[model samples]
Target chain A: MMIPLESFHLAEPVLAYLDPGTGSIILQAVVGIVLGAVFAIRMFWSRICMTVSGIFGKGGMEKDGEDETEHSG
Target chain B: MRRSTPAERRLPSSFRDPSGFLFQRDGTLFRQVNEVYREDFQRLMRPDGLYDRLVSDRLLVRHEEAPKEFVDPELGFTVIAPERVPFISYPYEWSFSQLKDAALLTLQIQRLAMEHDMSLKDCSAYNIQFLEGRPVLIDTLSLERYEEGKPWVAYRQFCQHFLAPLALMSYQDVRLSQLLRVYIDGVPLDLASKLLPSRTKWKFSLLTHLHLHAGSQKRHADDAATGKSAKARDAKISKFRLTALVDNLQSTVRKLEWKPAGTEWGDYYADTNYDDQSMAKKQELVARLAAKAKPQSVWDLGANNGHFSRIAAEAAGVAAVAFDIDPVAVEKNYRQIQSDQRKDILPLVLDLTNPSPSLGWHHRERDSLAERGPADLVMGLALIHHLAISNNLPFDHLARFFHDVGKSVILEFVPKSDSQVRKLLATREDIFPDYHEEGFEASFGQWFEIEERISIEGSERTLYFLRRKD
Candidate 1:
């Protein structure tokens, strides 16, 4: 005998609440690391270059100072 | 709280924010703050001192509390009325510098909010509005208390709305900023990543924010499809790290600059046929006509750097909107407005051929250019030839459009014999047979009554002041 299909009650399925696109959050994490590293490098690169140049080329320091003043002015 | 009548209407665009929504009672606007947002509202108003700081800096719109009766009894905890902006403009209507300024202002507000133990819950460009010739944040409900180790919830929204559009405009074509009109929630990051040049991947900021970010989004989408959605909750960022991220984003924005140059209309005044006498005469005529009408608001179409618009504004003491097709021209106009501390003129980029249309939910959130008007007066100086000859728009069509958008128009008609008209004819075939002064008069005469006409002193152009027929 074939059973009737209308007798059962199905519970409502719970849907996940995603306020922002799931893709957006994942992407942010990957980008944050890269952004931090790049910022650190950019912040220190000029100072490091200046220090190394100063140590290696002591006689050229006066010329560099003049150039810096000219550029700044 | 006072009882609201049946006339109380809520704005559709303001419905999404659960904290509060803007409603109109009679003709005045009011914002109803719900009980759910009481704590945050108190933080913004009281202990934090954020409201006072932002208001004093003029970074945020100012508002005053209304009686409790003004609120809806069910959903409302408090009611407040904000100062009305003269005209509400959308992101798509803004020029490059205007969008950039809005972006910077959002970041500055975010930084300020962090200091007050709060963070912006949303970073939608729609929250910002131009007031008193400057951009100011209008949403009081956009802030929430900051948690110690939660990722900035608005990061993605900020990137899509401000960073993506700014980057695209700076690196690629300026017109690409129009993508904001199509994507009301801001341009999709994946699309932005793909549209950007491959070399942009080598630039640290673009590499991290756009290209790699797009890749991660794809991966997350794939994971979500397989029912792995819980991963989003697992990813947490410290508050210090969040501040650093914001700082980096600010620096990226600061570095991405577009110097508006090389556009056709940018150097228009330099090569114009007008001599000093003719220019002065034109200015005098415009001022006299404007004074006669005494319009409260004026729109200067094709206002290249706002030379004549200023005459109307100053003479009539009216608020003027200076619109141009060229970004460079609008930029120059805005820079002058800033430096001069002028409160009357607001410059925006607009191509008349395809002006900004109504967009967002049900096409009602942002108003179309036509809906914002019938301005008191519209000045179309040296603009007809380009629309009529260059764009192949008939005189009748131009007349109808102008009549519909403004109560009165001051139109400058450039005859076929004019050098400017000759220049336009040099490039294209002379298809406009009825582009002469008589055809112009006959077509516009149907919709308007010609009040006065004057021949400019050293040019073939004749300026006509027409008032729309009832």
Candidate 2:
């Protein structure tokens, strides 16, 4: 509910600063540095995977759909 | 230094930011810049600055520097009088698309701030308010001079305020946005992390920002500058990395969508008890009443998709707030407002049984619904039965409520004979013995002077227009 800012130990707890929730700041740094590279790599890999899947996935699409043997009927 | 009189009241929410605080002097709102933030204030107000760009683009609420006399020499750098927003609706009140649009607006402002050699120091959702049917940043002091290698102070806020709630609403339920009322700062990341389904773990953005980021907050929550904490505290982020982070957030926000479907109120107008002819007649009557009232502002209670509120606002050429119980209904109304570029009506999610109360420090930070009202007209088109019969609210209480929020009231009285009222009575015992036409008039007569009453042509319903008795 209503969390008192003091309950969460902020880096600047000693001062009268609007505690930017220390954990959030650190995570931002971590995500900014690490996730950026991971995301870029993931994007490039996904593109390649999509290209490969685009060719093979058509067969899977046909398998998933109901059989359309209208000419035989 | 002149002492701040009773008339010169500082806003409670304004005390959080050290740069500036908003205060009202003689009924006019003004943001006073502290001496400490003089440089940052100068940078923000400079020629071709972020303020000019944002105001020009209608992304930010416009303001003007107040006269010299308004300044408090002891603690003030300057004072700015901002253009007032007609209605102050919260994030909890917004629909999925409304919240999403506000999110995108925040991100856009952030990027623009960076481009202008500044950064949004505080990304609280409260900073954004809808003006003229568009979300605009109301807080002028949210931005500060950009420092190299400094991580965004408001990233956690942006996630908690905008990203977390948006994700939960999209993945789980639209009602999840209401969690903002309980958690004031935004939905707690850990709570959001717990509430969100496991399937969200596979979504790259949600995984990194919400789940992993939540873990990071929990990990460093109590830790000081020791090993992992030290590394986190002293971490340096490149501009490129920051840009990438913003890009990720932008893409994530842009991708999230809620189609406003499957709710009971989705097709309310079509499935209502009224047939085409009766509905048309009701609309014509409402338009006539609105014109007759000559309202500058109207409040439509239980306005499902704002059917009648739109008529009232359009016919009177006035602004109106359409409040409804279901988020879906409000969302549909909001989407229509966006598509039509309608500027007169603001649709919000509101349960009349327990409307939004006064909130924050001494309950003064956000004004309650009643505090924002006494609207020129309050139209309760086809809603009295639901309150009196379904909710078991007394007619006197309803009358007082109507009188409190509105100067004049236009109420539609749905009789026991009405099919809709019969449907309500069919499910439960009809305990409302005094729920009749004369009973309604007598009860409301205590607070209002009955001016006119017109019965609908095809329906067993009467529309009464009454002016509040002083």
Q: Which stretches of candidate 2 lie over 4 Å from their true place?
A: A1-17, A38-73, B1-3, B70-72, B225-231, B260-268
The fnat scores of all predictions, in order, read 0.35, 0.50
TM-score of 1: 0.86
lDDT of 1 by residue, B1-470 (tens): 34446788777688677788888888888899998777778878973389998899888999998977545678778999998877777887777778888888888888889888788888999999878778889998888767656567787788889989988988887888889999998889899998888888888878877777777777777676677767675676666566667877777777777765554434544656789899888889999998887898899999988888899999889889999998778877877777777878888888999988888789889888899898999999999999998899998999999998899899999999988889999977888889898999999999999999899888888999999998
The residue-by-residue lDDT of candidate 1 on A1-73, one tens digit each, is 7652322424222121115567666666656666656656655775676787778875443222111001000
What is the DockQ for all candidates, taken in turn? Answer: 0.16, 0.20
Q: Top TM-score: which candidate number? A: 2
Q: Given candidate 2, what's the lDDT at residue B432?
A: 90
lDDT of 2 by residue, B104-142 (tens): 888888888888778888788899988888888999888
Q: Weakest 10 consecutive residues, lDDT, candidate 2 chain B?
A: B260-269
Candidate lDDT (C-alpha), each: 0.81, 0.82
Q: Can you tell me which runs of candidate 1 are displaced by over 4 Å?
A: A1-18, A29-73, B1-6, B69-72, B225-227, B260-269
Cα lDDT tens digits for candidate 2, A21-67: 66877778777877679657766776666667687775332222122
- Model 1 chain B: weakest 10-residue lDDT segment is B260-269
